[model samples]
Target chain A: MSVELDIILSFKDKMFRLAHRITGSYEDAKDIVQESLIRLWKMADKIDKYANPEALAITITKNLSLDWIKSKNNRINKMQIEEYENVLVSKEFSPEKSIEINQLHEMILKLIDSLPAQQKIIFQLRDIEGLTNKEIAEILKVNENIVKINLSRARKKIRELLTKIYNYYEN
Target chain B: MKIEELIEKYFEAETTPEEENILKEYFTSANYDKKLEIYRQYFIFLNSERNIVPGNFLPASILNENSKSKTSFNILSYKWLAIAASFLIIFIIAFTYFKSNVNNAAIVITNENFNEFKDLGTEVTFDAFFKISEYMEYVKSSINDIQAVNETFQILQTYNLMNYQ
Candidate 1:
């Protein structure tokens, strides 16, 4: 009913997605989303006057996610190694199709992580989270053209990485 | 335009986001040309991961969490609060330093400043403040960074206060 509610309803899921993608942990993502919402909730009275409240929300979510990742770098590295060992261990134990699919999921995440910082953020904002170019530009504090170029580069690299995997799997 | 045309424009960053979405859809679709097999699963994976929202995470729940607890440790205990409070003090110090020392780059907070507060004996006395302030400068200097610095300051809230049976 209220403008704040409208803004939160519109962007909370997207904020969660942004946080989750960047942090790679659902619990931390949820915490970041919750913290971002609390911030937005504080500004609820003045939210409507902003030109694009969703951009503000996404920006907050982005900053918080970056902070969360920085704080958890050690834990994340441990998890990645654990996940790597997981896929390795399961290679022989699991059924072929499921293993391949799971490995593909992990590899995609790795590929996304491998991208240059700007390109990865752009791809996450554009393709994964589905923000418009202008919205992403606002969120990243960059020009729309920058967003476009980064997204293009990210996609090209992802395509190359996936092609290698697809080839490996097929042959 | 032909799908090939769209794909070409996409690689060049010439397509609008909406048109890119169409390319995404076409690539993931069953009818897409088999020659694009290399990119098919990739697109499909991107689409699936794009849509992967964590379940049962509702906006109302976040609001509810905020409203549920007014506990003392909830928000104030966040390190940002401490850092921010420290930053304000540093900013004031910087302001005063800039007022006095127009020639220098940094303002040193010497042991002399702590002496001024040392006489004020109370639970929130100068000693406690000194120790707590000490923990701040070492690792926190990077955090307190806003053009003010001092070679002195030590201690940050010790365990003796909570010594209980």
Candidate 2:
């Protein structure tokens, strides 16, 4: 149990980032990652056979996150990603500076959440989690070119949205 | 490379990780071109997103369950120990009870035998006393008869002398 738990904990942050990118909620991401680790723990014996356990864990988290979204949709009460951004915004902050910064972060998160799932994950993995395109492709089981294309689209869309907001504020 | 060139490369998603780092540094430093100020917030958000962790929300039940399993293992061992101790106690009690009953039975048998032997001795002594009394009476009767026979013999001698005179 110790060995398995340690192995799972090593991937905790990475798995959370992947899940968070998909689910757009810290709480949901935590649940998804926890479930992914549990599943990994169940297959601890065969996990060594996989060359990249991290990638396997990420894939598992990604699928569970998608499943979470599906189940939420089936319930007909899908939660807004902005609600989770509010949770992220409520953290300890200095009065004026922290509020503005948190709002900016929240707005950026909301914008990122608007991207399609593939583009969103690629952007998170590359720009935020700081993984190489090759690694992202490996984790996604897609080609490096696809990963690049999605990342480019994600960055362009976010930049386009930000420019609109900035110009509006300037006016 | 020029900051403008790096910014263009960044939006194009063609910047290397190092080049992106330089872009992030330039934007966050707030010394970049005024036109790039909008992108500064975006880069700042990215930098902040990197530090955002799930933070101690890894489901306490998992870790708690592990501890609970360890506790349950200890409890299982204690349960077996308690059962074994109970068995040992029962065995000792049963052995003591059997030994005491056997000793009591042996004592009762010895006492019953001693009482039977006393009753048989008393009966034999009474029979012997009765037999001795009967033998003494017979001897006395024979002595009397002998005395009578002597007197008769004297009388016969007196009668024969008178006839001769």
Candidate 3:
């Protein structure tokens, strides 16, 4: 395979995963990845010139994800006034380990969803996607300090929320 | 380290990657105190969530479909030909319009010059009438002695004579 194809295949999963985490919806994530692919393909001639194809792809994915979120939020706000109603309702917990695991997953997803937009993105990139603060800073086009601050804030918020839920379950 | 100190360090941005790994190890161990079991579950939940991959097939399918899409321009639509023809027609029309306008202006200028010359002829005739009137008043006594002066006067006064008749 050509370097271009190799690079694409190598970064495709990372791009999709990052996009998925950023958008919080599978379909939007897929669309963002496809859009990023199209962009990379269109600029194929310049691919070899960049030192880091993954960084380029990540930047493209991040920007496209941000745009997708903005548009999707607008559409959701316009069409669905009862958007958060379902999320706010608590589900009954089960004693089975599998059921508990599933419930825990849902709760974690909800907690992540409740995060502010920038913090959510920062958390997704830093924690879920396993990107370093420097890499995330490059992808987000911000200072490393900002990335650190956002990541710290996001992690702290998630920890507090998880701790509260845990205490409630324990008692 | 005390849980409070660990949590404080985590918040203060002082935790190194090694410290974070230690915390994760501490949280995930089965032998951690019962009080910390819930915290253990939370950390396990986070660790599991990190690699979950979301169970989504849409991104792969989209990429497959996108790969199949042609990046090259389609000639079958005839769009390029249509654009070229439209541009050619516009250029031709603009050229023709400007050429005709220039030609028409030249023709109008020539016509105006011809009309001016015709008006000059009328002015010359009017001047001749005035000269004849002055001659009639100044040299009325010698008017009859001039050969063909009566005929010239009669030719000049033909319109007046016809109207009177």
Candidate 4:
């Protein structure tokens, strides 16, 4: 295989996972990954236009996923808010003590879902995907300081939300 | 960095990944202070939630699609060739039909010698009719028969030559 194909194949799964995490829709994520690959393939010969092809693919995936969400929301604007929460929340908890922890996890996820789009993305890339600040910055087309600031703000919000939940359970 | 400064930087969102890793390690350890327990569960949540196993390989069709489109430029070039060939085909067919019809008409007029001139609407004499008809027929036949198509082909060849050069 050519070097471009090799890179695409190696990162395709990671791109899928990133899209899935962002959209919470497996089908949409898969479609976005495929589209991103096709776009990269088309531009492979002129890749000198980009600093990093991997980052370019990632940016494409992110933009496509966000566009999918926008169109989906437009179609299903009447969907109940909790329905979305239920789709995102893990329902694998129904025990005596574990149920409480599960609720906490759900609350955390809800808070994450409530974050501003950029902060949420920053937190997801840095904390969950385990990418470096520089990688996140390049992929998102921002500076490293912006990545740090967004991540910090996202963490602060999660901390505040989780602290509230903890206090509520304790009292 | 010292533990105190690390905690301060952690809350301030200024910690490097290395420092963050150290903090995660310290928080998850059993011997960590109880007052900082809130931070531990948060890290645990981040660690646990990130376990989304990237599920499947890229579909075979995706890779196949790239290979399939490698010949797209060839197809595009053939598109132009097909269009040019079609125009040339139509030109040949039309030209042959028109030239043969003209030749056949010329032969009939020359052989008949104005036998059908009675249908003429003019009140002219036979001599006038015969002379005019014969001269016109001769002019038409010579114009069509004397290498008209050959001259057109030569012009077309020069067009192609100019394009190549």
Q: Candidate 2, clashing residue pairs?
A: none
At residue A125, candidate 1 shows an lDDT of 79
Model 2 spans > 4 angstroms off:
A45-49, A71-103, A169-171, B29-35, B59-61, B77-165
Model 2: DockQ score: 0.31
lDDT of 2 by residue, A124-152 (tens): 88998888899889988899999988999
- Which lDDT values do the candidates have, in the order given? 0.71, 0.77, 0.68, 0.72
Candidate 1: CAPRI quality band? incorrect
For model 3, how does the per-residue alpha-carbon lDDT over B11-45 read when each residue is reduced to its tens digit?
A: 55567666767777888876677766656776686
Which residue ranges in model 4 land beyond 4 Å of their true spot? A45-50, A74-101, B1-8, B28-31, B65-165
Ranking by DockQ: 2, 4, 1, 3
Model 1 agreement with the true structure over B33-144: per-residue lDDT tens digits: 9877656666677788767766655556545644554443556577678889999999999999888878664434468766664454354556788888887766587766
lDDT of 1 by residue, A82-114 (tens): 354344445533445333555666776776665
- Best candidate (score: DockQ): 2
Question: Where is model 3 chain A poorest over a 10-residue stretch in terms of lDDT?
Answer: A76-85
Best by TM-score: 2
Task: Evaluate model 4: give its lDDT.
Answer: 0.72
lDDT of 2 by residue, B1-165 (tens): 898888779888899999998988888894888887778888888887787777765556667766776698899999999999999999999999998897675323266687776766577668887777777777777777777777777787788778887
Evaluated against the true structure, the overall lDDT of model 3 is 0.68
Score residue B29 of candidate 1 by CA lDDT: 72
Query: What lDDT does candidate 4 reach at residue B29?
Result: 82
